[model samples]
Target: MAKSNNNNRNMSVEEAGKKGGEKVSEKYNQEHFEEIGQKGGEKTSEKYNQKHFEDIGQKGGETTSQKKDKEFYQEIGKKGGETTSEKHGEEFYEDIGQKGGNRSRGGRSNR
Candidate 1:
């Protein structure tokens, strides 16, 4: 009976040791998981911030380009208008003068 009691006590101690080891392992695993999750979150945030800044920069460039395009079109339109005005003014005066001179010459000749 004494030997049997000693064996039972040893079994209980072994079971307790296994339970304690399992608890420690579980705690370590949980802490490791938390640390990994925190690192991943930080990396993701950094990437997002970099991408957001790039997008803002691209938008600013696009706006500047749009303004430049508008100015270019306005300058072209102004130049075109000036050229047309000059051409039409000269042609109109010359055409009317020639017509009057031809008519006067024809009347004198007929007389």
Candidate 2:
């Protein structure tokens, strides 16, 4: 019964694509990714401007926040911080802090 239920959840091509995209990316070389990414970015920029980007980003953020609770975000944030700390070391935080400080030099700015 359980095996049949699990088998019922067979993947479609799109689902397979989404699941294996990371594996495919891992198999490829960096230059291939960079080239394809640049092409995709160019196409996206051609189709959508600043306002379009802002609208999609806003919608995505809102939908994600609604779907996931505070604890979910906190866990991901902690994991991301740990990964960054491992890869870049403490100096990475100092550089980022200075960059962030430079960006917010003036009074409170509106997003």
Candidate 3:
């Protein structure tokens, strides 16, 4: 049993490579990899944005407790816009269309 465990722990390059290939084939099936990758990437970006927004919210709350006014809100909005532009490039704003105070659930069809 000890010898069997030792043998299991040591793998030849060909055996290890074959195992790796099997894992790639099994986990990244041709029909699902692209969809899985896209979902994972979107989730990652959403989490990042949520964390960033939460931090901004905390800072805004702290500042409001000290001195709150329309100017304070405007300043936060301006800073957020500037930071968004800087991170995503100036063309980012053009990608989003204006809404007449009614936005869909993220571009889903009405039907």
Candidate 4:
């Protein structure tokens, strides 16, 4: 158990982690975290291949899907759609729709 100086009560692993993370965040800027994350990602990419990533992604997706209900997925999908709509204009959707239509009919070659 971890103890915080502020209180006599024992801190949980989660609470200690949150406190540590907050302290680190206060000390560092966004770029510092971004650089660390990039280096970690590069190291992970060097260690694992496409198939390993695909396997983990599939497993994670399966676990998440099992834990979440249809309404949860619908809510997330709606939120994502709203965010995308805000970022893109009508022309963007038109172009994507055209590309999708062409792909479905095999009118254009795959990228």
CA RMSD per model (angstroms): 31.1, 8.5, 14.4, 3.4
Candidate 4: tens digits of C-alpha lDDT, residues 5-67: 876889999999999999999999999999999999999999999999999999999999999
TM-score winner? 4
TM-score on alpha carbons, each prediction: 0.21, 0.53, 0.29, 0.80
Best-fitting candidate, scored by lDDT: 4
Which of the two, 2 or 4, has more lDDT? Answer: 4
Error of 1 at 72 (Å): 57
RMSD of 2: 8.5
Q: Candidate 1: where are CA atoms >4 Å away?
A: 1-28, 50-111
Q: Tell me the TM-score of model 1.
A: 0.21
lDDT of 3 by residue, 61-81 (tens): 888768888887898899998
Task: Evaluate all candidate structures by whole-model CA lDDT and list the values in order.
Answer: 0.75, 0.82, 0.71, 0.94
Can you write out model 2's per-residue Cα lDDT over 16-99, one digit (the tens) per residue?
776679889789999998999999999999998999999999999999999999899999999998887789977888877777
Residue 111 displacement (Å), model 2: 30
The local distance difference test score of model 4 is 0.94
Model 1 backbone overlap count = 0
Residue 85 displacement (Å), model 3: 0.8
Worst 10 residues of 3 by lDDT: 93-102
